[model samples]
Target: MMRRKSWQKNLKIAVAALLIIYAVEHILTMNVYLRKPMLFSPLFRVYNQSGSEPHCPSVRLSTRVLPQIALASYPGSGNTWVRHLLQQMTGIATGSIYNDEQLRHNGFPGESLSNGSVVAVKTHNHYAGKDYARAILLIRNPYESMLSLFKLANSNHTGEPSVDRYGKQWGTFTEERIRGYIPLFASWIKLQDVLPIFYDALKQNLTRELVRIKAFLGQSGIKGDVRCALRDSEGHFHRKETGITLEFFYSKKQRMAVNSVIDQMQKMFKDRFENIREDMDTWKL
Candidate 1:
């Protein structure tokens, strides 16, 4: 009888402890839900409360059929930031060809193959065998873009790199990255339905550029709250300016080499922007 009583008491204590934990968790979840309704919202479906402006628009998969459009850019050319802006403006999640775990966990739930469900798929590769019906080519100055990539690589894709991190390896890295631009731009330039968006232009006028993008995507029907999107324009992955200077990435010799490549890229764009008469096979990748 004594052992039975002890066993019953322990079982009761364990049951009570579980109940307490459940209650605490429920309370906490409720608190979060009340404070930020967007936090608990689902990613694959739109959620809009009646007669109230949403705190943050819920990102959803495309409800209507859409073309497979790519948001193409070199790494560190503000691709993630542009996706954030578009997500806010459209309430549709963007996709990516490469699945980035960090991006999937963060805002981009659609981090897979470029498909109709996503508004636009992000990509860095524009070589042969990589083709899309339409593309938004995001261009940033080579120097800043390459430096940004270096920082991202060093800091695990979210932070700036330390000055001490710069060394001999960076020089080689810089050369390789700068060379990559030629083929990337060349491939995209051949596309008939491509929108070339400069990074600086977007910074200067976001709303105007968004309007252009919306028209191009044939999404003028959906009324996106531009003001709300603009409220937090700088998205999660944007690395702010830091004290670490990036001048050491290139020496005078390296600068000349980089500039020569830049000149060739400009010549290609200028010569073939309207007419892609030049044979693509001849261009060295």
Candidate 2:
């Protein structure tokens, strides 16, 4: 009888513990799903939202106004926005390797065709086209870029991931992307006549960056206005701002490893572009 009672008592305790655990878990889940904001909320209001400027006319290149220039950037590095700005400034449609149906219907009629039909083609691959002679390489902070990639992967271009998805995937996804940056930068650096544009700097000064791009493209006779492009700088691709916290998501060891790689890249850029003092500032957080 004593042994039986003891076993029964233990069973009772186990059941009570499980019930408590279930209750706590349910409450936490409710708090997350019902009360808390998303983990991947927009962390900064970097772009302007107002602009009634007529949609920039998208036209096919008749005589190859610019050389075979690739507008190169990693996924989620604001390539679409840059393309929009380029169209606004140059009045010529930008082409891309992947023909996104949404982009095609929305504004990018030059989607999927990287020939002379477009001024500069968009490419995410390291191995750009053999015919490509020059490129405008757009670079963004790895942290921000990774977050944007995660959102794009989990949701749409401008949407946030579910809290549960973020909890399960964000850490691993971020670490992998952070590591992937090394080889991406390494390969692209080899391509000759590459102009590196920092995304943050572009956000800070839209018109200035567009002017720089205009001069780089060497198409002075284009019928697009660089100053007018600034009025609608934040095109349809920019995600809505939800918050403004730039926290480091990696652990100490991982942070050190990523920083070491970034330091090497910054040094490489310094060697490549002598006037990169402002661009070097992008390495900071």
Judged by lDDT, which candidate is best?
Answer: 1
Off by over 4 Å in 1: 1-56, 127-131, 219-225, 244-246, 272-285
Q: Write the per-residue lDDT of candidate 2 for residues 1-285, one digit (tens) a residue.
A: 999999999999999999999997897577546643222214422232473444545444535445678888888889999998887667788899897898898878899988877868898888543767788889887667777888889988788777787564777886677777867767777887788898977866565567678888765234566644654566787788668444644557655666677787788788777687355444545
Give all TM-scores, in the order shown: 0.71, 0.73
Q: lDDT values of the candidates? A: 0.74, 0.73
Q: Which stretches of candidate 2 lie over 4 Å from their true place?
A: 1-66, 219-224, 279-285
Single out the weakest 10-residue window by summed lDDT for candidate 1: 36-45
Query: How would you encode candidate 1's per-residue C-alpha lDDT over 1-285 as one tens digit per residue?
Result: 999999999999999999999997898677646542122222223334574555666888888766778899999899999898878877888999988899999988888857888888899997454547788888777777888888888886677667677887688788788778788988887887788776866775665566667777764244465545665666788777776444545788777766777668668766756643233222222
Instruction: Report model 1's TM-score to 2 decimal places.
Output: 0.71
